[model samples]
Target: MTAEVDAYLSALPDDQRAALSDLRARLQILLPDHHEVMSYAMPGFRQPGPKGKMVVGYAAFARHLGLYPHSGTVIPLIDCAPFKTSKSGVLFTPDRPLPDALLSQIIATRQAELAAGYGKR
Candidate 1:
């Protein structure tokens, strides 16, 4: 994990930290080749290489934690029912973290978008 990300997580409350840390661990496994980064003030993983696109990101909020796909289109493509969702992220509490399958789907969708040259700046 990057120092920026470490510090970000370190500053959160225990429950939020634990929840995000667990999610981070799962992401590390899913995107083994991706590099950890802090983008848009949130911690997330980006594809490897200097120009690698951001694949996924997440953060802790006052009332919940959010998973950001880095692309506004990604969250809408997935089934985020039973949880709160915005155009670019999904929110859940530490008590009810996102399921493994759903997280995987979120990552997959974002990766696909990156591969297709969406979100290029």
Candidate 2:
């Protein structure tokens, strides 16, 4: 974990920090091994393939937690009606953490995008 990421999480209120921490743990477990770093001023993971790319990223905000798959292509690929979503990511609250199935789908879709050379820039 990067110091910036630690500081970011550490600065959050306990509930937010805990929620983000849980999300971080889930990402780490689901994605392949990678450098867990601070990217886009947020907690993110970068996989070491095809020139060490960023596979996914996430952050916590005042009202919700944000999960970024790092690709616009992934936004519409998954069904996220249960949560709020935008072109870049999904938003959910701490009290209502994202479901395991949805998380897997997001990560899977991101992985497919990477494998397909879709999100590389």
Candidate 3:
């Protein structure tokens, strides 16, 4: 993980820190070729190379935590039923962390989008 991301997670509450750290570990394993980055002030992974797009991002909030797929359409394509979802992200909590299978689906969908050259600026 990047130092910036480490600092960010270190500053969060114990529960939030633990949850995100777990999520971060899962992401790292899933995206071994991606680069860890602090984008939009949140911790996330980006595709390799200098101009690679952001694959996914995550953040902590007062009442909940969020996993951002960085695309307006990604969340809709996946099953995020129990957790609250928006156009760009899924709202979850430390008490009820996102399921491992669901997180895998999210990463897969985002990677597919990147491969297709979607969500490009």
Candidate 4:
């Protein structure tokens, strides 16, 4: 992680910082095979397999942290509730948090989406 992203995440209130940190840490645990690095001016974790370079690949955004699966199927996972995604994202507000359950779902879905070659990756 870059000092910038670390600083950014660290600067938030303790709860918010912890929320993002927990999500980032969980991503590491869930995607051990993925390449974790700072990309696109954010902390990114890529699939790190034969097709790794296909995408940026996963990034943490300004308010919410997320991944870029490339296939775009991730849209549906957030379409329902707790998340509202546009054609490109899962909208995140500073008020609402990126939940652990949802994080797990996103990780699992990402694994599937990556396997399916969805979005940029």
TM-score of each: 0.96, 0.92, 0.96, 0.63
lDDT string, candidate 1, 1-121, tens digits:
7899999999999999999999999999999999999999999998999899888889988899999888889888888999999998999999999999999999888888888889677
For all predictions, the C-alpha RMSD in Å is 1.0, 1.5, 1.0, 4.0
Worst 10 residues of 3 by lDDT: 112-121
Per-residue alpha-carbon lDDT of candidate 4 for residues 55-110, written as tens digits (9 for 90 to 100): 32334455564545444566565533756665544555446755667766766776
Candidate 4 accuracy as lDDT:
0.59
* lDDT: worst 10-residue window of model 2: 47-56
Report, for all candidates in order, the number of backbone clashes. 0, 0, 0, 6
lDDT string for model 2 (1-121, tens) is 6788889999999998999999988888896578888888888998875577788899887788899988887978888988999998999988998999999999888888778887457
Ranking by lDDT: 3, 1, 2, 4
Q: lDDT of candidate 1? A: 0.92
The parts of candidate 4 lying over 4 Å away from their true place are 1-16, 49-71, 77-80, 93-95, 119-121
lDDT of each: 0.92, 0.86, 0.94, 0.59
Candidate 3 residue runs with Cα over 4 Å from true position: none
> In angstroms, how far off is 19's CA in candidate 1?
0.1
Better of 1 and 3 by lDDT: 3
- How do all the candidates rank in terms of TM-score, highest first? 3, 1, 2, 4
